[model samples]
Target: MGARAALRHGAARIERWLEIEREQLVLWLPVMLGAGITAWFVLPDAARWIGFVLGSLALALAAMVLPGGGRAPRALAIAGLALAAGCALIWWRAERVAAPVLARPALAVFAGRVERVEQLPARDMVRVTLSPIGHADLPPRVRVNLARADAPAGLTRGAVIKLRARLMPPPAAAVPGAYDFARVAWFSRLGATGKGFAPVEVVMPGVAPGADLRARLSGHIQSRIAGSGGGIASALATGDQGAITEEDSEAIRRSGLAHLLSVSGLHVTAVTAAAMLLVLRLLALSPTLALRWRLPLAAAGAGALAAVGYTLLTGAEVPTIRSCVAALLVLLALSLGREAITLRLVAAGAFIVLLLWPESLAGPSFQLSFAAVTAIVALHESPRVRGWFRRREEGRGRRLLRGLGSLLLTGIAVELALMPIGLFHFHKAGIYGALANIVAIPLTTFVIMPLEALALALDMVGIGAPVWWLTARALDLLLWLAHITASAPGAVAALPAMPGGAYALIVAGGLWVALWRTRVRWGGLAPFAVGLGWALVTPAPDLLVTGDGRHLAIRTADGAMALLRDRAGDYTRSMLGENSGAEEELALLSEAPDARCSPDLCLVEVRSGARRWRVLATRSGYMVPWAEMIALCKATDVVVSDRRLPPGCIPRWLRLDRDTLAKTGGVAITFADARIRAVRGGGSHPWLTPLTVQPPFAARPEGGGRATR
Candidate 1:
């Protein structure tokens, strides 16, 4: 009787909790859907279908039995349905977008029409997106890179071009959960990527109609303006970052201006506000209409149209689409003279975006964008927060101080909201973001954005020079400010990589705090506190082995990652976002006490507890003493070699070489308790483009070499 009573008591508490959560089903439904989308990234490829099936079955069963009695039952039913729908949605979208796999890397000559051209100023490479080649099995688009040395004179959209190209499957993630280039490529409808050699022949000169027109116009805008300033102007005007310099990009990131560079909320808000005002003023200028109907409804229509225009002009990327949807929702509320941009609208907009692109749950852009806006909206609506800042002082001096204080507080709130996300995704925070925002936000929101919009309009009449000049100047000032701020000591702080589930817990806590309708919402704090502890406690990886490649990196006792000078390291470094100058600080091949090397081979010793492990990394083409090779292979803990080792030379040695890489691609490994565990770049999903391969005589998987890069 005691045990049964205790069980009933526990169940009662759960029912009570559900009853409370059911009141906020509006928020809960979307949050659950978002979780389903996230499960796509977390669950392995094979297990994804299981989630979809189980989730769907749960919802189906709940729907059959009307959940009308207890609030807990209703809430549970709703949650189950949402989760099932979310999982099903992932597969629905994935299957719809799935296309052919390249299977392996290959070089071939091809012909296709140029759909788009991207000039990468930093890499000095021209990227060309082409229509599907001769093969019907290939994807609809193929992207090729032209080395600066071999770049053609130019490329025009709609122009049919032919060139010798090396084609291969899109890259897998550099590390598990790092980033999935393969999935990105699949969604982009691009099956292959490779370098092109020789001149691009224009069989037919033309450009695709419709949306490419906007892209073409952007290019023309760049052509009309001159120099790097033109690049920045074009980028700001039409969501293109290809021309932006890498150095400037870094500075922009450090100064908190990077988000502004992306085509999203800031740009959309400025455009919508301007459009609404312009329409209202134009309508007011007409005496009859002004007297008859001065309601915001008509202006709301104009704002929606303007937002749509901007979305189209910017290629309708996921971020742009999300912003536009939210903007339109706000405009819809304005038509009814209701409060715009309320939590209800946010929740509705989020649900709509999830339906449109369930895969976005895995992208940092989606997470950061939504998280920032959600925090801003919640804070702005908080009665207590608003009450504290309500002051009536009217002097110019007092007004200036109040305005600055408001902006500063806003900056602090946004940064606080984004801290967990920033650390988890990019692994860095701008120490000077607040200071930088004080100087930069107003300039960007008020001056730069306005001028860019005006410039686009002026360009149609060939009189945009004045606006373009002003816009360029504003951008130049922004760039200057970014450089100054980034150069300051401690302007950027590096964060250690978060442990598994740390980010998810943070997300859950944030959602609970933001979504709960009542005071019990404070309960979310427990999960948040636990998550923070985990993030801070998770240890940085001590060993990094190239997944299928020969390159190896090790975190030294002092906390710096050292790469062997002879190995390919730069490519992996880019993905990892090593703190500034990590490469410069990396120990050379000859620096380790127990490691020594010649051109063909190097042997190093590693320790875990009281035991030592030997590792051999070698390139085989060059001559090497065989007797020493035998010694190195004796019970070697790991071997990544290009050469064929003597058969059973050392029975205990673990070999990871060209053949292993050919079959499995690359993997990273960690060492512990008398064993080595390897992690592939990431699991290959059904959605990935299949790749085919032809290995050469000396096929070495490059950790950061040509293969991985």
Candidate 2:
């Protein structure tokens, strides 16, 4: 009785404290997000520890400053602070330990079994995780980022291989003002990466001949599951991304339904829930089974089996495991007759995940997965959206409509929930992502799975081409859909990446406001505002050039425009578009001339006067003489020449070489001082060195600035 009273008293006191300082808490959110962003930069390979420590320190300080006179409030504050601090410290320590280990380059002959394999399309690379054979000194698992060299020949599960190659830390963020790749990789629990190897030298331990039988059996099961349904069943049964095409991916991204592609938490839950329902239905049908306890046990068993199968189909990604574990917890709690699900289960799931794969916290899958979970929980509890889902399960049409509505709602919710991190890391979003998901989700889930399963089964039977053809058709259809949707108006948007400080605060604030139901939620808004301000007020580009610089980019209040050059091919055309050729990039430059991709040439409109013919100078071509083409020059007021003018224009051009001519032309441009530079070169400039020649156009000492123009 005394212990219960003390606990109640403590809770009441903490609630009062939160109620009193809710506003201040909101102001702290930006600080936390800023910390998270900074942590990414400082320990890009894995810096969760730093954020953890800092957050803990802040909480401790707040606890110390609390004016409460009661023992319960003071103790509660200290506990909360300690928890935050511990999380931060753990993040920092994990990163420090992993960075050097991953970065060391050496030829390691570690024997290990294949844990998982993933294919990356952007880099055309394949990554595999290996469980070290007997090396106790190293982490239990290490990730090998290798090219798919000869993998098609034969590489199967449980095959122990001796890999030989130079292993180094994962690649860091290569592009400037981009995501912190180092941190991202760290969160992925990747110890090291390697490339460049020959399969001939690598030894693969032989497996028993019967091992092939098991592979065949698994293949058969996977095939049947994949072929069972068109889109939905395929997604549910096997996490075969091959069933999804580029177009469907785009549509899903645009529709904000991309989560439906991989067998993430939702899919896992769906599978589990379906299994549980089936088990319960079976129990109800059997007159011999009257005990409620038996039903829970049966459901638990079914859920575990389904979870394991789903994981195998999806390659058992970290996110899948997290979801599985969390679902298992909920089921267990239910079996124990718990009246309600507590956040403890979710917390436990997080703890187990971090303990198992400490690095996963940095990966998108981890963040996105957890973000979806947190948002769902928060939204479900929200005063407005609360009970909305539970109240609408009547009628067939309503169920279907509600299902669709729920998916749409989920997409929007997840996207909005993850907005700060998404913007900070990617600086853009597929505008039409939400719509794409609605169609792709159903199709991939029901149709593609069945096709893929059929193909795999047929392959086992030595006649898989028919199934393969069907799968191919499914892929083709998806690709076509994504292509069409991606081409649609406002299909994508690009913005500046969020600054570190603002990003951290946003993240912190979001956690406080979104997760905690206390008055501290109000404090989250401040950081959110700060983050938005930074994103919305992005810095303008350093230079803007109209196509090929023959026509200057017109600067406007909202943005600047570089009228594209008509004389350039696709490569140069894209470069002139500020290194972006995606839908959003093209849409932003809508006023520019249409860009045509062709076999030999790509033409874009140069904003220069139509009468003034402009050609980007190549090694073989020089500026055309204006006098010779008086007809063409009639409407042209001025000729912006990039080629060297005759020696008469320089007065000292008696012995001119390519260098002198190039220097003279480069300096005579008003936009040089601006960020834009005009490059007119071709082939290799082997002779060029770190040397410069003063051009005649150099400004005199008395002038305000250089008079290159």
Candidate 3:
């Protein structure tokens, strides 16, 4: 009887839990549905948020009037519905504001407070944001991409400056056929972006020297924290990533430890947990305050302090804000004795982010942050899986092992989750990424970050002695680790361009697997398989030809390519990834000889040796005889010149040098395959004439060729 009762009790508990989860899911159905629909029919040239708002309001009314017996459900429904509509509406407004700014030939003049600066050393680009100046139509901030290669000029927040610039639209999605730009301008609510900047006079109005104290304090803290043994400290404490070089960034990214740099849920959760432990320890020392109420009070205080400090340090970005909200929600739930950390929290936080700053949904930060948190929470809640690491204890050995395991798990999970995204956005993946992350992540979390924080504090107090020593040591250690990791063989792998839908499917499948504990482990497999297949099978042009044969690029089956330049235009070749740089498409083209062409319209008739070949340059041009060059042309392959042709003969296509063509058009006869050959008697080097060509001998079964630049 006792054993039977225990089994029954266990079954009862599971049923109850499922019931609760079902209720929660029902409550959020409207929200998820609304967000899904809004994201689906998004338009480029038209405002899309209007439909989203109408749909959300309609859903809310339906929920309110539904035949259910609960005030709580109705309230939840109202909140969820509002959040959904709000997110879409905000995105719409942001895009509307940014559209005019991004239009070509559009110029805007405004004055605003400087908010922040982001410098990308690898891309040699810098972005600056400014608070709005005058018009409501103008964005709350503007981003400028530097057009020149000048050494970094420091700009701090609160500095009022004016400028004249042309706005360029944010990049559109290039997902083959999808709405380009991912509707980012809509999601982020950004006003405008520009390619250049000419700073107007800094209107220096006499103000208190310490008016902008937070920036000063953060900067001081960064200096001190950087004194420690790792790059992690400086990153954790302050958002200044300029210290992380390109090589270091690449190593960290490859190793999947790049998440350590972003001050998102992980960073915030760590700080919160640490603060709570400290506070609980303090209360335990008092004995009298070890009560449950006291615990709640301590948690609240510690969590709030940590949230504020971290947010301030990180510049209150969208990812940081979302993390802060999650932390706050978790703390509140603990205080209120609520055991639910379901999709509700995730949805709520997402809704808030989109409602407040909808554009964040389009950014990698927002996606990565939520992805990590959602995966972790779902994994933690799974009843079937045992704890991967034991609860924290005082044993130093145990602590170290646990830390290492956590690092490994986090790296693997995040990288796996983001692999498709990285490939789609970057066209490359780091083979050495996991190894790099293993080495770098723990070092940052434990030793380097703490020292950097300490250094920054010391610097604030004007005590430069010990902090400088720490900072130097930390920098050397980080640089060494990065250099070694980056040098590993197969450290980087290049891939062909990935289609946008492939990324979408992969991301969706990954999320489903990570965020829900269904028997859907195989759910992610389909997208992964599809993405890989698409990448391998997509058709790309095999050859790129120029009219003069001076410039060329070829593509291979694996989507790698190479270029060959007749003259020293290294920049052009580099752009094509023909030289030492990594351009997958151009790299493949460099390996074929039979596919290559010589100067003029010459076809290598036969190979005499590695260095010599029998070549023929067809005097290819267009002709107009009998008003058509068909009978003989159709019977066999014929090349003609427009000038030599009587009356009007129309060949399939005409080929001519830049100077020879009578009409200039956008299409450049780049690379030609065997299907095209030069016309006879067009001219030795035809200029100022139309040229005709016939397909190369497709049936000749020519051997493969390689071209080099």
Best candidate (score: lDDT): 1
Candidate 3 displacement at residue 499 in angstroms: 2.7
lDDT of 2 at 486: 67
Identify the superior model by lDDT, candidate 1 or candidate 2. 1
- Cα lDDT computed for each candidate against the true fold: 0.70, 0.51, 0.52
lDDT of 1 at 342: 72
Estimate the TM-score for candidate 3. Answer: 0.65
Q: After superposition, how far is residue 416 of candidate 2 from its true place, in Å?
A: 1.5
Global fold similarity of model 2 (TM-score): 0.60
* lDDT, candidate 1, at 89: 89
lDDT of 3 by residue, 414-453 (tens): 5666665555655555665655767765566566656655
Per-model RMSD to reference:
4.7, 13.7, 13.1
lDDT of 2 at 215: 39
Q: Specify the poorest-scoring 10-residue window by lDDT in model 1.
A: 700-709
Angstrom error of the Cα, residue 214, model 1: value is 2.7
Residue-level error in angstroms, candidate 3, position 561: 2.4
Q: Give candidate 2 misplaced runs (Cα > 4 Å).
A: 1-154, 157-169, 179-254, 291-293, 339-348, 355-358, 387-408, 438-484, 516-523, 540-709
In candidate 3, stretches whose alpha carbon ends up further than 4 angstroms from where it belongs are 1-91, 94-99, 102-200, 206-234, 277-296, 339-344, 387-410, 518-532, 535-559, 563-709
